[model samples]
Target: MGLLDNLKAKLNPAKDKVSGLAQQHGDKIQHGLDKAAKVVDEKTKGKYSDKIQTGTGKAKGAMDRLAHKDGTDAGGATDTPPAPPPPSSPPPAS
Candidate 1:
């Protein structure tokens, strides 16, 4: 395996654990993000409100991706698993 591949393999377990945690505590994590952003915005006297909002949105998006709640795979595909085909009707007897 290449260097990047080796690194990814080593980090896979940690990544899974983090994803699980994110999924479990997503609401709490998002609340914290909003709280921090609000505080920073207030501290800056709303001068960076837009920037703060953008950053917060990006961070939330990343969290959703990590939790696989964005309905996308690693390749960014939104394709869901194919459903089973319906059973065919039997032919009439001769």
Candidate 2:
């Protein structure tokens, strides 16, 4: 195998391990992200609230994508169904 192919072969196991860890500890990772964001926001005295929010959202989106929560299966096909919307119209006035 060539240099790039050999490197990929060696890194494949590590990649799988990282994916598994990301799936297993995703919640804890997200919580840590939130806590860190809160501390930074407080330290900045809310001056960068919008930027902080945007960064936090992007981080969470990346985490979700890493965890494969975007509905794509291992085969890269979307095997999950879309989420249902919330109910509307307050029980039709009873």
Candidate 3:
């Protein structure tokens, strides 16, 4: 096996364990993220409020993805389909 493949195989178990833990404690993890963001925002006196907010959002999204809350397929890409756009009017009868 390739070096990367071997490394991935060895890490799979730990990754699974962490994924399970993330799913179980996602709320707590998000809370901690929020708390940390708040502290950092305060420390920066809102200088980077937008950037911090963006970063926090990205972190939470990553955590959700790791926890499989985003319905990812085996390839780790989201399997969920985008919502269909609303029709402006009913389609004309054929």
Q: Lowest-scoring 10 consecutive residues by lDDT in candidate 1?
A: 82-91
Which pairs clash in the backbone of model 1? none
Question: In model 1, where do residues sit more than 4 Å from their true spots?
Answer: 78-94
Model 3: lowest-lDDT 10 consecutive positions: 82-91
lDDT of 3 by residue, 1-94 (tens): 9999999999999999999999999999988978887777777776676777777778888888888887988886787643222112222344
What TM-score would each prediction reach against the true structure? 0.80, 0.67, 0.80
Error at 62, model 1, angstroms: 0.3
Q: How close is candidate 3 to the true structure, as a TM-score?
A: 0.80
Q: What is the C-alpha lDDT of each candidate?
A: 0.75, 0.69, 0.76
Once all C-alphas are superposed, what RMSD does model 3 give against the true structure?
Answer: 12.8
Query: Which ranges of candidate 3 are over 4 A from the true structure?
Result: 79-94
For residues 1-94, write the lDDT of model 2, one tens digit per residue: 8999999999989877877888999889878877777777667776676677677777876666667776776676766543322122112221
